[model samples]
Target: MNVEHGVHDAPYFVPSPSRWPIVGAVALFFFALGAALTVNKVAAGWYSLAGGLAILFWMLFGWFGDVIRESQQQQYGQQVDWSLRWGMSWFIFSEVMFFAAFFGALFYARSIAIPELGGDTLTRQLLWPDSQAAWPGNSAPTSTSYTPMGALGIPAINTAILLTSGATLTWAHWGLVRGRRLQLICGLVATIYLAALFLALQAYEYHHGFLDLNLTLASGAYGATFYLLTGFHGLHVFVGTLMLCVMLARASQGHFSEKQHFGFEAAAWYWHFVDVVWLLLFVVVYWL
Candidate 1:
């Protein structure tokens, strides 16, 4: 544990040169390109997208495998651990900013654009003379029926599920710290189930919106923002659930220790962040 010691106790650990980063970049490029092309109705785009995802997943598996091996070998000391913590923190901060951009868009559209388009003063009278100034706004130039989503239904239930999952995740962390293997496993399993259930309910909500409610992206600005925010949050929940699954798998293999489980802590941080973002979304997008 000495800060200035040799290989076994070095404070810093530098990894060997990696091909994974370059590979990941390539995979991402293909994936983005494919997605764009698919959006434009290109037929071959699916193949490229699938291929890219496969490659990306393979790269992640290999990269994580190497890191896990190093972790098990105890190659990382306190300084290296600190570095990991800092790295994960910054990553989460970046994710926060990413969500902030979308939330800002929602705010701007609601507070400024909608008002300017609907107010009686100048622009609305001149441009959209027949439009109503509402949160969902006009469905389109053709005026399709629009029903705005409220916080009282599926959104409320999903919010509760996420909050509960956050609690379960915390309980699992406590179990990990206390070395109660059964408690930790049960907590993680419960969290994962909650996450999956939340996703299922969200999908059902989307189905209801599209079929019964007619809330499509093309429905109006409200539909766009609602889907944009909630859809991305659902994707985050999927990712967080996957991360928890990995953590649970590692826990089963006895990979984490009470003092040195940054992996679990990082996943927990991300899950909690997702939960908080959902709460905000529930208020702003669904309730407000």
Candidate 2:
């Protein structure tokens, strides 16, 4: 290796300062303000929220477009690639902690809070005489009437759908590794379809819960936990689907090669994390 060439490659690539960060901060300010106002029933909150979401999307597309162009131009060296992997790993870890907090809430509601409330004679006699230490119906301070979602129907089907998507994504990765463009594209298409189907089923399930079963966020602890877990997971699935769609577009354009495909791998990691969260939700929120 030439000494000068080696020295030149040693320095990592640094992108020039951009306006996207400030734009993102402004978007987040709108989001925060919008959320606060909306929670208090302010009318303008809707417009603010919409504007914030639009700005956020614009920032994401612009920033990601820049990165994609840089990657395509081969500006990202192995150092950048390794740093990206680490960044993605930390991102997934943060997501894990985020879900963990929700799960902790569920566990606390079920195992600790409900039981302590029901089991204490003085507390129950004075506060919630009718309350019982139950999983679904009477778990709250007052009796709540709503059908609890079960694991038998849509939940089970969604489980299988998400698991299958994981498999298809893996197959796509294998195809990319083997330099089979057709196989990769087909696998990604299948995965995207599966993900979309899962989202559709979940939406229908939510509709059924609200309309026919009278289940909602107002239905007390069960409803709150159910929607919080499943709704957030659905959002994750939606995001993962979008990421896969982008990957599919790039793959169609012959972007990723056999050796360099961290973008696809990052998306795959996130999708698998979503799948695992759904599995836990199925067992805990629906079945158990």
TM-score of 1: 0.93
Extract clashing residue pairs from model 2. Answer: none
- Scored against the true structure, residue 108 in model 2 reaches a CA lDDT of 95
Could you tell me which 10 consecutive residues in candidate 2 have the lowest summed lDDT?
Answer: 1-10
Q: Model 1: residues >4 Å from true position, as ranges? A: 1-10, 139-143
Cα error, candidate 1, residue 99 (Å): 1.4
Which candidate comes out best when scored by TM-score?
2
How many Å off is the CA of 287 in candidate 1?
1.2
RMSD of each: 2.7, 2.8
lDDT of 1 by residue, 99-167 (tens): 999999999888887887777867777767776667765734664787887779888988899999999
- Deviation of model 2 at 105, angstroms: 0.9
In candidate 2, how many Å is residue 55 off?
1.4
Q: Runs in model 2 with CA error above 4 Å?
A: 1-9
Q: How far is candidate 1 from the true structure (C-alpha RMSD, Å)?
A: 2.7
lDDT of 2: 0.90
> How many backbone collisions does model 2 have?
0
* The best candidate in terms of lDDT: 2
